[model samples]
Target chain A: METVDTLIIVFAVIAVVGSAAGAFLYDPPASPKDFVVTFTEEEHDVASEESGSVSGSTISDTVDVPVPMPNVTALELTVTMSPSNSPPVRANPANAVIIVKDPAGSEVGRKTITWASTESGAKSVDFDIAQQYLAGLPDSVDTRNLTAEEAETWAAGEFTNRTATGIWRVTVQISNPGTVPNEETFAISVSGTATHYHGQARLETGPISGAA
Target chain B: MVKTQAAMGTPEGERGAWSSRTGFILAAVGSAVGLGNIWRFPFSAAEGGGAAFIFIYLVLLLLIGLPIMFAELAIGRKARLNPIGSFRKLTEGNRLWVGAGVLFVGVSLFIISWYSVIAGWVMRYAFGSVVGSYFDDPAGYFTDVQTGMDALGYHIVVMVLTASALAIGVSKGIERVATIMMPILFTLAVFIAVYVGFLSGSGEGYSFMFAPDFSEVDGSTVRSAAGQALFSLSLGQGAILTYASYLDKKESLTTNGTIISIADTGVAILGGLMVLPALAAFGLLTGENAQGGAGALFIGLANAFSNMGIAGYFVGTAFFVSLFFAAFTSAISLLEVSVSFVVDQWNVPRKKAALLMGLIAYSGGIIAAVDGEIMGFMSGSWTDAILILGALLISIFVGYVMKDAIDELDRGGIRGVGRITIAMTRTVVPIILIVLLVLAIKVEIVDQYFASIDLFGW
Candidate 1:
């Protein structure tokens, strides 16, 4: 019977159009194609909690986001540190991140959120604190308008919270003693097309033994 | 009650005839669209060469996947029997393929039993998504939901659902549930995918999934793509053959196969659309934090949704509900594959067959519901071996054992496709399946072989 023909046709059209648009919108194969992956060689520096800086391992987990000029629409860039699978699934965790540049740097769209650690019956499955954090971001990228609590709450927070894509040149420098040699060959690949300031990669200091 | 019904005996047409071509298409597509379309497919696209993988997958489906599907359908239509009876009838009393049908029945039971446990988890997750069960701790939620009597409860519910659909008989039950569920599955997946498209900075995820990053193309990419195409289509398990057995002879198997293939591939690509863009929008797959694995979607989306506040609640509910529907339809087909055999081989009625099999699979479902050693063993090694071996056996039986395969296909108006199907089933598919089998064993059992021994303190 032709009862379901319309349903099939509608989905068929969606399939064709979405796939064709995707196929045409981007051409990655024509470019360099290979992923140039490299890890940061930072010293195992566990900084003091008061200062939030580790043993000089680039001030503990710094993230660099290459950005266009500071005045524009919102953008989001994420940084995660883990061992790569030629195709990765889950990898070992790298503890912390410290985005370089303070108030001046922070002004360029700074809201660092720690990834949520879910708990309790009320927390439920669909709750995503990170998404909420992103949604809470102001339409304007100006950091001066932020309340003190907002600045502190959003400033260099963990990977789970603070949401919405913004223009932040984040630098995450990991100095985990628990990390083995070459556990994670870190790679920094930028998303979004901004022409202004490219979030530069900060060098991590070596251990005393290695430095000697 | 079912036993009494079985003793009375019903007519064959009720057990066999599809209500219409549309009904048949719905059922076949139902069998194909599953958790793989939602959970596995997106992760796979991102892992392989993204768009390049898509390109290779389509090619393989056409040159490889579709022909075999046609051949399987042709076999069923020609013989008009369950897998065992059909193979036996086609081969004219040759015992070589008798095991394939039996193995298919076994594999179907094994797969469905294990699948129910997972489907139950998806269902619970759907409920939890709305009610905020894991909002406090997603990892803790996964840990809690993955095992124990709570999981068993969900498993039982899923098995009962599967039985109910089957109990209603083929036309009213299987056809109706499938026709309703498959459309919802497509609509929900597309709905989420379109929403993701409007995300402000989602180009990265889209590119990562569909941009054809050819440099990532390698043996693993091709192997994974080929393997996915084979498994995602629900081949090798005789589900297709069983569904086809119920088809009207007038329906063209080739056209049906093409439509099913398109729908399956479309859902899968759309799944990628749903996931990859959302992750990119949330900043999940930056090469830095690209925790590329099965959990990436769960973790990233959990973060994204949790951050979305109230809107995330509705969106999350929609996604999980869609997943549950997808899992439900596939579970029905898996149950039917085995139930079909019981009806044909024995004098059992359809309802009785569904009940008896449902109860049996339900027992295994309990064990699979556990998140411990026993559950892992059955779901991991036991099921994978059975499925791979089933596929290998089907390919070999059709190619080398069944002499009238060409004629069987020719009976369905398919000419050159028979030769191609035989060639792939005999040669290419079997060899690749072997590799997949070995790799699975190496990863699941052998790699852990030593650890398991230590675990038991033997």
Candidate 2:
């Protein structure tokens, strides 16, 4: 009985002490971390199918850019559209709008470019989103006045540990279709790179029907 | 303290004794492992404090759950009767003690009344998986069938199945079913756990289940851990006691009790390993996507399976079928507690008692199935209160009041430590149960319910 009593006391003490030690010493699961994630640049080409009477018509294509897909700190989209005609046309103005949406279906960035069409090989427009966000800061809110952490947060802008991480959609819509003497063919290629944090486990979603 | 004079061997009035020690252990294990393990444990651990919650829960199970389990078994084997009969016989027909027995039996009946309804839901899920009925929209399917006439129909189906097993008698029915189903349940659970481990991002499930974040621990966490230990073990309900009553005296209570405890806990851990990882892989483990209780299992996991294409069909079928076996075994034990009482108290045959009690429980289940709120209310704080109160009183009865209870515990190859167990039961067991009981009422009922009404306008 005495041995049993002593054993019981020892066991109870161990349980109590072990629990307190574990409570204080135990480490939590790691939080989603912030890191610069780079995406390999890829060009996707889309051709306009319309030939004659191409005015008032639009041609558009959406592409999926593969990146670490969340908390994007830096992104650059370069759109190059080249149009060719049997007889070259002059001053055929065309408007191009580039749209980017995150996995949550929230539109995060948009850029518009307009140019006069010529028989040139290619016309290029560049959208550097991070610089745009940095430039968008309020005039009165000076970066020098901010604390180090605050400045870092401000620099990260809308990309600080954003939870939306799966798929990113980039769509380019070209309007005011070509006015060539005979027929016109426009080839547009959209390419970009994105930097984001890498920590959270990527979602393993199955391919959806009709998704490219 | 009047000692019970019933013989140490098998008593005359037992419904039926377990044919072998293995059958008894398997049946006891079956009773302990149920929907609580599969549906509730993973989420509870996730919500409580992950591994910290598991640690506290294991401590409570060792210190408190096991002792009470031993006491219940000892009392049952010694008296060799139903809870009411056992109490009356042990206490020399003391009315107050006899009423305690009635409460134990009543708690079993109360639990089963709604328990069968949920068991019915498991059945529907099992069948639904085979037919691929819920694959299209899991959440919508659960909502459509979880209540009303559909729930009632499944509820009746579950009740009839449970009653049929009971009516077949104990050794042939309950033991036979447990012997066969327990192994199958283990195999299916292990198979799923292994299969899901190969999936990408499943490591998050491991972290979610096992990473200890002590900051989440609080008063409610401790209370929840303690309550879960008792609830998961199926202690404080007459089911354990009732099952013990049919045991042969030569079988060691300590050995059987220990095995049952370990087996039950193992099944719960396996369930966590299986479900949590699969949920993480499919990106369904997020707070926004994952729900609590049955919704976590039925809706979230169901949706994950639907996305898995052809493979989901086989795995989903295996998962729900194992769950059905687990639920069915437990529902049988719950029904048996009342059936045993009727058989012993009224000199009724086992078949008739099972039928009568089954019909009554079936009717109560219909009401639960129809309303759903009734099921919630019955399974909530009030049930916790009853279960805790019963355990507290039994500990007191065995430790201080009942004569030769330690002697009974020492029987059947248990040589020593009976006195130590009784001492702990008298002191630490009651104290812990009292704390848990108060916390159960304060947190579950008062805090949840009265806060809404604001009766005192505080």
Candidate 3:
């Protein structure tokens, strides 16, 4: 019994000491961090009528930016209206999946992108890559320059840590109305990086209403 | 108090006293520490600027939580009955007083109903940790487990555990289990905090939890902090009062209340250290990528453990197991309230009373588990409302109605009682609680209800 009491006392000391050490020695990120990623927009415009539901999504075209999606901590994607009068966009398929394809049209890796918006009139949503996307990412994929094209892959097979990195024909899908204009400009930029406009947004309808 | 004490008549030797002071402390501490510590407190801290909110909670715990606890303990020790019986015994002829007692028991039962459902979730997570089921996808796993038959199945498991502990009777059951399990629970909480402290990136979590920004202090923050302080200590529902009723006269209510409050608060702060660091390290804060639900957001944090490599499985399992112990101990206390009620009032045997109350609470748990709308109403709005109302009434009864209440506070001349306790509970705490109750209802019920109405455009 005395032994048990002593053990508890020792454990209690460790808990207090350890917590105190953490409290004093460890400091949080004192300031809020803002991420910047440049998006090179691809073709994306899948109509809900063709997709059969307001929640349907299809890949337009993938953007190649300086910092891959994994590197940026968070991103706020804003939709610009063609008429400049579209209601604030309501994004569906709340989780957008970005698939990495090799130059040969072979698949390498994929990451799911999550975003949050208002109940209505939400023209933009912030996607926290570190929290939502990267936590589930395979260690095989390098987080730094996570989506740099295949040329960056280690040479001579002398790689200490290797992951399939090059992505070709990435699929960036979005659903819900007013999120995309007929000829919307997809802007891609990394946090703390210069904001730059990318290619024309082209929406592709997937498996249509009669999709198999 | 004097009239009822004589008229209601006293039954000597009807109930067993706690075998030792340690036993009493453990039982009260066990009841106070549970999901409130793990589930709500950290989330409140996160919402209220981490350290700043914890500061408010501690202040309230001292001013509001401690005084009310002492108030309840004094009443129960003197009356030496279940909450309903204690009230009936204290104010023998007053139906309103008896009604207040009924409300006390009802609130305990109500809280356990939803509480058991969440405990069931903890059980499932603990089980999943061993099999590596969520190794790849924590979000997908929790979403699947949180609804339908999955939730009900686990609620039943917890309900059975609660009944079994209580059926064995108070001393052999509550006192014995509390003595053995409380140490284990405390050790688990501390060791988990220690592990968090050692983790490389966990410093951010500690910073978020322990260091107050002070800028985030606001009305909603106060509401959340105060409700949590009272709720974590099991103040409103008579759990502490019930446990104290089992204490010997030689025991100092003030000293015992302080010990229970300190132990309860220590475990709660430790829970933040255990959980928040991991959540921050994994980047699992509020975002699209974050898990939904106000109080039950730890699922997002628990989901991150699988990503921690081989150590994740062991840590995840141990965390959930400790969670189960925490939940189970508290469930036993809540169950004991209704069980004790039947035993005292209906003259039912302990075993039968345990089973009956357990089954009754199971039906309520089913409602809480199956319907999200109902669960939110009861757990968030109703629980606070009942608890705050219960606290108000208990204070008024003791401070205003009960005769010689000040003299009662002076019992044993324990450290923190007497004129100040009466002024705090009788006057200050109840008034503060009323304002808090109004704010909590607006935030919890009206805001959510209005949001849903807007969502549906009704």
- The per-model DockQ list reads 0.02, 0.02, 0.03
The DockQ value obtained for model 2 is 0.02
Cα shift from native, residue B348, model 3 (Å): 1.3
lDDT of 1 by residue, B184-249 (tens): 888888888888788777788787777677888887677667667767888878888888888887
Clashing pairs in 2: A37-A196
In candidate 1, position A203 carries an lDDT of: 16
Tell the DockQ for candidate 3.
0.03
Query: What is the docking quality class of candidate 3?
Result: incorrect
Which ten-residue region of model 2 chain B has the weakest summed lDDT?
B2-11
Off by over 4 Å in 2: A1-212, B1-14, B288-291, B452-458
RMSD of each: 17.5, 17.2, 16.8
lDDT of 3 by residue, B1-458 (tens): 43332243433323556888898889888899987787667766876887788778888888788888888888888887789888887786478888888888988898888889888988898899888776654544554455456767788798888888888767888889888888887777777777767777777777766677788888878887888878888888978778877778778788888889998888888778788777667655433212224223334565557667887887888788888888888998898887777767765556767777877787667766655445555766546767887877877777787776766666776534667888887778888988887766666656656655543233
What TM-score applies to chain A of candidate 1?
0.28
- The best candidate by TM-score is 2
Off by over 4 Å in 3: A1-212, B1-14, B286-298, B413-416, B450-458
